[model samples]
Target: MSAIMKKAWGYRYWVLVILWLVYIINYFDRMAVLTFLPFIQKDLHLTPVEVGQLASVFFFAYAAAQISAGFLADKIGSKRVMYIAITVFTFVTALTGVVKNFGQFIALRIGLGLGEGHHFAPAIRAINNWFPFKERGRAVSFFATSWAVAPAIVPVIVTSISVSFFGGAWRPVFYVLAIPGAIGIFLLWRFISDSPKEMIAKGKLSKDQDIEEENVAPKKLSKEEKRKAYGVFLKDANFYVFTLCLFCQLAVYWGTSTWLTSFLVTQHGLNIKEMGFFASAPYIVAFFAMMLGGWLMDNVVHRMKPVALIGYIGSIPVLWMLGSVEKGNTGLLLTLLLLVGFFVNLNFGSIYAYLPKRYPKEIVGSATGLANGIGQLGSFISPLIAGYLVTVGANGSQDFSRVFIFFAIVSAVAALCAVILKEKKVTKVPANTIGSEKSVS
Candidate 1:
């Protein structure tokens, strides 16, 4: 098994593949609602505010679950936490097909958020566990592409499925989407371990590198241990700034993603089918944006702030210009969407690359969880505020100008936060250096 595994692909690459696929499933299920927002809104007689509530509520639940989930990942093992997450979220997704009212939809959306929120920090923990310093940047960056990929293709795939197979019903699309998630569960069990030491001890892999891993078993933590873990990151002043920056970035991200489809349809006057392809245009550029951001962080900048700052600053003008676009100008609209996609997405790889370098790997899950969890507050409010700003006229048209302005404001905030961040320097150790700090910058 080991020889065949090594011959086909290294175990680390296999882990990346499995995690990436699972993340794609995670996002596909999450994005299905947004892709068909107009249908869901129409069917439920939902107002603009309520349409925004569905998206914001999910982030609220997702954010609320993150800290506990991060702590759980540190305690129980990333793989175990992931197993629970995949099962719960997938089940919740299937149940979404049958909701009959706003209350039921909110209940199930909360379920989906709680289930999926646990997966991310654990996945970050796993990447740090498996990859060495130099290569970790590229590894995490590639894994992050699942975000762009799932949303990029989901609009086309889900839209086509709804229009063709289910006769344009949104609910059935959720049911079809749920089936593929089980594959992620099975893959995680077959191929993943919590750490390299565990993999080596189990005879699934050989000790191929100079990594000296701690043989920490997943077990119940003492109250003091938990406190110390939480306290360590809590005391770090930089963590607050980092979290704030993440907050702004996610605010822009979720706000744009959650509302972009509706904006294209209602304001720009595109049919749903045309909206799907146009909706996907920005994210296609985003896939390359993340890749290039990762490459630049690893090879060129060697610092995360510059990359993040550039992304935030570069996106501001693009976002502001989106308000100037007139309906039926698909050419200019596509150009602006593509630009906004590139700029907002460019910093994720750089931000992700910064985490393992900034904190001890032992506490990375907690650090990441808290930061991202707080960041989700931004995620929650952006959509809700956008929904509030979305003025629906008596004639059934939407004015989305304020939403674009809001995104630009947040992008500016993120750039300012990036400017205040201090660069970190990792001490280079010999290949045999183990159990201390890993390379980040």
Candidate 2:
């Protein structure tokens, strides 16, 4: 590669790229179930509520695991925690292909959740370790694209395999899905380190690079110090506000995403192929929308709240329209879903940009983990609640319109919480981490 090319794809960006790919696999495992939900529901003879439970249980387990994952990443190092998470979840994903009953299905979902839950906080911590506050908007925003792209691709990829290779078997797609996780495992082990310093030591990163945490080695915190870190964020009102905001955001994201297939296939009368195309459309738009949102956060607003507030407020009408669109109005459905994808996803760039800036680098993982964990409570509730909201028409077909209305209301709650978050600096980022970073959360 040319020097300019190498500089553009340098270790800093490569780290982000690796984490992004891993997260893509993570969503693939999570959302593949949703994509295959109608198939799974039929094959297993499952109720809509039961299908919701399968998705909900994963978040419950995922939410429960986040705090501990953060602490362990802080304590042991992100590399190891990530290694373990990847191993457990990939194994669980493959096991999913073999599930013959509901009990086994739920078990795999929880296992997937528990294993996947640990990956995010640690990956965020690793990014915080490398990028300074200024570059983080782009770095984290790009990483967040995995969330958008993976979901956009999942419906198509899984549907194609189910139809073409396996003759519509949902089970075999899990086996295919597990391949990326295996590749991610090798990538994580081979190239990634917990911090830039470790990468430098391994000679993967060139010496004398202008990177944060380039000289500071990873530290293992004592029990007393860990407690003190937790206490620091605990006292910050922004912590509570951010967590609540995440809860609301998760409701909008997971609640809608978890049930998207059913909403398209069941309510709108789209076939699996049509559902795949329509479902992929929103997330495809989200990739560009979120990228623009992140760029705006860095150069335009120079803060997260204004940008995010706009997103939260903007999503309300779109989500409501998404639900209210009558069956067979394919044109309106496409337009509304596209708008939801754009407005709803715009929150992430600013949302993720705040964490590493707001908390001490030593405890960024814990802060992120705890906030995300608490936020996932919203993730846990929305799907199951949406499941319950499924109305049976006189024709006995299920309608999921009420679920989008629920998300619309929850988006308003998120907007209110976003209002509570402060823009002023809250915690001092250690000089080694960011050369005097201000609180951005």
- lDDT for model 1 comes to 0.81
Candidate 1, residues 1-441, lDDT tens digits: the string is 656454212667788888999999999888887777778888889986677678778999999888878878887889999999999999999998888889998999999999999899899888877776566667788888899999888777888898899888888898898778888888898889997677778877776545544323333446665565455568766679889999999999888987887799889989967987888888898889988888887788777888898899999999988966999888999999999989999988778767776665657788888888998899998887877788889998898988899899999999998999875633322233322334334
What is each predicted model's overall lDDT from 0 to 1?
Answer: 0.81, 0.82
Evaluated with TM-score, which candidate comes out highest?
A: 2
Span of ten consecutive residues with least summed lDDT in model 1: 427-436
User: How many pairs of residues collide in model 2?
Assistant: 0
Provide the lDDT at 153 for model 2.
76
Question: What TM-score would every model get versus the actual structure?
Answer: 0.90, 0.91
lDDT of 2 by residue, 1-441 (tens): 335323312666777888998988888888787777777888889986687678678889999889889988888898899999998999998998888889999999999999999999999888888777777787888988999998777777788888999998889888887789889999998768887677667766565545445225546556666666566677777888998998898888988787787789888889867987898888898898889888888888878888788899999999988888988899999999899999899978779878776776787888898999998899888877877788988987987778888898999998998888886554543323222325443
